[model samples]
Target: MTVAVFDHEGPWTEEEYLALGETSQRVELFDGSLHVTPAPTPRHQRISRKLGNILETAAESVGLELLEAVNVRLRPGRVPVPDLVVTAPVDLDDPYIEAADVRLVCEIISPGNAATDNVLKMHYYAAAGIEWYLLVEQTTGTLRLYQKRGRHYVEHQAVKRGGVLNLSAPVRATIHPEDLVP
Candidate 1:
């Protein structure tokens, strides 16, 4: 079941909302509207899995931890679940993810949401002070990286499938396109 509350405006407190479990359900709260994305297609799942695996291996070697499809509460009223998130080492008692602690957030473009992923989500992450945002598209197997530049994001890199994903301010890891495509 999907729950949406629009009457009580303003962002919800992090502790009150982030208590949800990390299940298969993709949950997001956008612009006062709560949206639950449908279960990803098999193709989407394949890419998510492969990307997660590659990131996991890279993160493990570096003392960083990677999270998959987890609710990253940017603010009270804005929470987006990225395809993958790279974060600093979690404190023992803090299980929730906040924007300030995130090193990088990545979203894989799904049909009908490419514009939102590349534009709206880009604005949101940048405004929230997220240092790096990665947008990966399945259509062309392209990965776009954006670095925050004073309340906006400037195009950092756009790499095709065979190209490597280079990121600074988080961890240095190169992502091969074959690792993401099935």
Candidate 2:
């Protein structure tokens, strides 16, 4: 008889993942294994860049700071690099990004990451207690907003192209989907 063994309790350190370096590779260390994703397509980059800029601008108006694709080590071996993250002001020597300090997290969904972003990532973000998460789908040109509710996030709204996405209170900006994609 054969029994399966899994590294369920992983206190995997950061150094292991960093060694792989940047090759347009998107990888998350889960249970001591590397879950790697391919480089995002051009359309993905456009939406991500636009969303980052828009969020940064809006956050600035409210006296907040935003970080782009910064590593937020949610747990020991579960680190997923979000497209953009908004956090409170950090000291120059702040070590790691944690879920507690994050105000918002946005992910630009690509054809390859639709299932992971919409399903897998959604659960992870909710489990980490991220306040807000926005998903921008490039193919559909749609923006979906989710706000933390109890232990999960309920879809706040789905904004289509040309529609305005109103920023949550304190951060005021109405962004049109077309403005983000093109």
TM-score of each: 0.82, 0.85
lDDT per residue, candidate 2, 1-182, as tens digits? 95423233454556767555564666676546666677777778887787778778889887778887666667766778888888877663554587787788888888866898898888888888887888988887889889989989998878998788897743666879998887
- In model 2, where is the ten-residue run with the lowest total lDDT? 3-12
Clashes of 2: 0
lDDT of 1 by residue, 29-138 (tens): 77556565677888788888887777777777788888887777687778888888888777635545788878888888998778878888888888889998888788
Steric clash pairs (candidate 2): none
User: What stretches of model 2 exceed 4 Å from their correct place?
Assistant: 1-13, 19-23, 91-95
**Best-performing candidate as measured by TM-score:** 2
Candidate 1 CA-lDDT value: 0.77
Evaluated at residue 128, the lDDT of candidate 2 is 87
